[model samples]
Target chain A: MSTDHLDGNAAAGALREIFTTDLTAATGTCASCGNVATVAQAVLYTNAPGLVGRCPGCEAVLFRLVRGPGRAWLDLRGVTCLEFALPDPS
Target chain B: MATVSRGFFGRRRSGDPDLPPGQYLVTDFPVLSAGPTPRLRTEDWEFTITTETGEKHAWDWAALMALPAQTPTVDLHCVTKWSKLGTSWRGVSLDTLFEDVESAAEYALVHSYGGYTTNLPLQDLLDGQAWIAYEFEGEPLEPEHGGPARLLVPHLYLWKSAKWVRGIQLLHDDEPGFWETAGYHNYGDPWREQRYWGD
Candidate 1:
């Protein structure tokens, strides 16, 4: 399907609910294919049963979000590691 | 608690008798992918079946077309809670492909052209349950829908049906595939609402 929706930036709002930093600017490595890319570069599918973020290089699903009435489930098993930039003190 | 979006819920269609629990009906076939769609020529396409012992069975496009095909109308449920009913597809059955091979493996990992994988019990793929579908709605499947060929395991959540499927790896031990290892349910049965780990 055509990726008409925005990239992983579409996930920034949901992710901000759990993380203090802006995840859209974070970098991640795909555990399955070893491809590294910024979270914003990954593909996002918001129409499915949940919000699914997939790696841009290998298409491996990097994370999934399922928000319930009072709880949210975030799955990040597809990412081997994530590097978040430190805020500049200057 | 985090706020939920109402957009996540599609409108329910009346008179729909086959949808699973916690799903809404969608008229459009939404495209969901992790990466750019791989453009592959049918001439170069091949489907392989590798047994646990390393024996290999391969079929190119022509060889695959030589086999009998069946068109089945089935309902699809996505783990994300969208249901598309009566989708039609034409392809050879896994039973037809596995008829010649003899293996004792209880689990199988479906590999896709784009390095995606999903695991399932070997039994879930046999006995007229699944197909390597290449045609959707009487047209050659589109790459976005896993053209060339995609695994169709309608009974499970759609993720279990790996798109752009390339091969099947039979294994004695159950291995977590891309989604399974990533916290999606190992056996994604929509009826049971098995969308993630511990679901």
Candidate 2:
């Protein structure tokens, strides 16, 4: 559903920047690898607001990585580390 | 009025206690399994139909369309519980696609982007209902929806409905795809209620 269409290359670049910093701060593991599981890439799209980056280790892609309307909710798809960061932990 | 047959995510049923609803929809278009229109123009788009005898019949998109078109109304059930009914689609019947291919007795493999793949008995692929769709709802299919073309098998779960489909490869055995190997049902039969892991 990602209609916030940044140029594909640009989106990819933005994801790279987000992965390097924000993700590492939030989760120590790589987004792609799930091994080191550290943040490797991140991109914020107007459409897929909470969407995150792919896994750094395996290059496995995870669509719509973020959770929340204005960045408050976190639907981590049951991801443990991510859920812990939520203000209203379920 | 013809209504699409559908069910909800969860519903109360007498005697059965509870039956999970599975939703889906059908299209009234030529749902062809299309390959990527390479970013480059003038690039050759090649496809092949393999047979049990190990024979391969190859063709370009133009040549393939020239063969014939048959329309079938089918019930498309996605793994996500979305079902569409009486969707009309026109395409070369799998039987006709295999005409002269000489391997009707073998299995068929469908390959696509994102490492998605699935297998069907040659019998299933040859079903007159199967198609390599080119249009959806009377319009040229869009890219985000796997436009230009896509494979539409109304009989199976929609994930088996590989987007950005390319070619048909005849195989002697079944092979699980990215989803299937990751625990999706191999056959993906919706009516049989096959969907995710252990189904």
Best by lDDT: 1
DockQ of 2: 0.04
For model 1, report DockQ.
0.16
Candidates in order: C-alpha RMSD to true structure: 9.2, 13.0
Q: For model 2, what is the alpha-carbon lDDT of residue B173? A: 73
Cα lDDT tens digits, model 1, B57-168, are 9999999999999998999997767788899999999999998888999999999997878899999999999999999999999999999799999999998899899999
| Among all candidates shown, the one with the greatest TM-score | 1
TM-score of chain A of 1: 0.74
Instruction: List TM-score per model, in order.
Output: 0.78, 0.59
Candidate 1 whole-model C-alpha lDDT, 0 to 1: 0.84
Q: Model 1, B49: alpha-carbon shift in Å?
A: 0.6
